[model samples]
Target: MKVYLSVDMEGVTGLVDAEDVQPRGRDYERGRVLMTEDANAAVRGAYDAGATAVLVNDAHGPMRNLLPDLLDPRATLIKGRPKPMGMIEGLTREYDAALCIGYHARAGVLGVLSHSFMGHEIEDIWLDDQVTGEIGLFHATAHAYGVPVALLTGDDTACAEMTAWDPSVATVPVKYAKDRFAAQLVPVPEAQAAIRTTTHQALANLPALTADRARTRRLAVRWQNASVTAHLTAIPGVLRQDDRTVTVEADMPHLYRLFNLFLRVATAVTTNPPYC
Candidate 1:
């Protein structure tokens, strides 16, 4: 069987600082190494559970966080950003199952270094009225692709958040957060072991994927501040529905395009004084 893995840094064991997840920050290399180890553990688990191949997508920051040479030889890695599918880029109907590694909880999730995707600008995101994180959004997309998300790795709060999506997927809590920027980390080996076990269980109990074959859906964006809301209303039909929110009607393919456009606009707003 083939499996796809989406990996991030904030949810990796022992990492408590945002700097650790970005290339420009101190200790980022160290964080990448830890993130790689966690990915390897999942590779090991999937292989043990009879998977013949696995693909890993580096979904954080530049999306190039994982070291190509250090990753498991049995799996391929998809890096860089602006992918049409984002976290689930390389995934397809041919894949058997999927996994999400280093997944922090949703934005405003206390005790975890939590923020929704594009944390600096996105205040909150909702799908059909229910607030969700990247994990949930990606999970829905994965379901649409006919791939079940088999495992999720992160701090305890991240695991708790996953329950809002797929409660059956195995969860590996590699650390316990004290707050958004700090946590009590488990030793690397312990984290790896837990991830391995969860990976195995996830594949072992992997159920048929749930995909929304429906062609149309709504994705609403809620920015942290009004300025951000003003920035997006420029898109036709994307108007301020509320003080801090805007709603867009999208089919699956259009949804992907809108999401990227939104990401770009958000990134532009926060561009530093050098650009300003």
Candidate 2:
């Protein structure tokens, strides 16, 4: 069996501050080590569960956060950006299951370092009117290729959110969020152990964990500022729903591409200097 692992930074063991996730932060190195170890644990678990191959995708800022040299030798790493598929890149029908590591809750929700895709640029994302986060978005993308999300590891809120979506999905909570940047953490060793155990169990039950396909997919993105909507409206098939929201009707592949484009454009506009 083959497994795909999408790993992010914020929800890794003991990470409760945004600074820890950035490359320039004082604790950034420590954060990377923790992220790598957690991922290694998951990779180890996948192998233990009879997985013949595993691909680990670094799905955080810049998409190059994971240290390739430090990663488990058994799994191949997918790094860098500009890929058509963001988190679930390289995913296809050949994979038996997908594992989401170090994911947080949706924007405006309580989770350790929680934010949807872009922190301040996107306020919320809705799929068929359901409030969806990274987990929902990436899970849908994986599902499109017939890969089931068997295991997820993150903070308490992220685990709760995933459980609500699919009760059978195995989840390991590395921390309990007091707020966005504050959390009651699980020790690194414990978190890693939990992730390994849960991953093994999840893969063991892969047949039952496969997700059902959505009948229809309509993605609605609500930006934090109205200015971001101006850029998105220019995309073909993207409709301006309101000053701060845009809606797109497409399947998972197309929708994922549009979302990637949306993030690039929105990030560019939001970071540029204003001209009066």
Candidate 3:
């Protein structure tokens, strides 16, 4: 079976602040190592569960955080930006299962390094009228391709977010959030072990899983600035709901790609860092 892993950085083990995940931060080098190790744990687990092929997408800032040289050679890696699909760039209906690694809670939540796709620029997002962050958006997109999200690894709150979205999916919490930038962390060894074990179990039971059928996906974005909305409305089919909110309805993957473009536009117009 083929497995797809979308790995983010904020929810990796022991990472509790922006300095840990941002590329220029002092500890960013160390953070990359931790991120790769966590990913490696999942990769190893996928192999343990009888996966014939695995694809790992570096789904964090710049989409190039995971070190290719350090990654498990058994799995291929998807890195870099301008990817149309963003986090789930390499995903398709052919994969047996998908896993989200090192994700965090949505914006307005009190989890470590918590924010939606674009830091503070995106105030809120809705998929089919349900509030969503990166986790839900990616999950729905994967489901659209006939792939079930079998396992997720993140902090306690991120695990809860996934659980709220789908109770059957397994989760491994690498840390417990004390605040947005603070958390009671699991030791690196322990967190990696848990991720591996859970991933193995989740995929081992993949036969019992079924993907949600594709549907018309509706997306609503509430930006932090009205200027962002002004640029968004210029896109065909994008409807302005208010001064700072815009809504669009499209099928899966297209809606996901359009949202990526929205972030690109927001990035062009805003100067705010991804975190406060």
Task: Please name the candidate that would achieve the greatest lDDT relative to the true structure.
Answer: 3
Provide the lowest-lDDT 10-residue window in model 2: 207-216
All candidates' TM-scores? 0.92, 0.95, 0.97
Please list the C-alpha lDDT of all candidates, in the order they appear.
0.82, 0.86, 0.92
Give the per-residue lDDT digits (tens) of candidate 3, residues 1-276.
Answer: 999999999999989888899989988999999999999999999999999999999999899999999999999999999898889998988999999999999999988898999989888999988999999998888877778899999999999999999998999999999998899989999999999999999998864445454467789999989999999999999999999999999887789999999989998999888897
What C-alpha lDDT does candidate 1 achieve relative to the native structure?
0.82
Over 1-276, each residue of candidate 2 has an lDDT whose tens digit, in order, gives 999999998889989886788878899988998999999999999998999999999988888889889999999999999787788778877889999999989888878777888876678899989999898998787777778889889999999999988787899999998977888989889899999988988899875444444445899999878988987898889999999999999877678877988888887888732110
Better of 1 and 3 by TM-score: 3
Alpha carbon lDDT of residue 224, candidate 2? 74
State how far residue 181 of model 2 sits from its true place (Å): 0.9
Q: Candidate 3 — which pairs collide?
A: none
Q: Between prediction 1 and prediction 2, which has the larger lDDT?
A: 2
Please provide, for model 1 over 1-276, each residue's C-alpha lDDT reduced to its tens digit, 9 standing for 90 to 100. Answer: 998899988999889886788776799999999999999999999998999889999988789899889999998889887787777687777888989999988877784668877765677888778888887877777777778888899999988888768788788899999978888989989899989888987898889765664657678988766776888899996878898898987665466567778877877777531100
Which sections of candidate 3 miss by over 4 Å? 207-214
Q: For model 1, state the Cα shift of residue 15 in Å.
A: 0.6
User: Listing every candidate in turn, what is its Cα RMSD in Å to the true structure after a full C-alpha superposition?
Assistant: 2.6, 2.9, 1.2
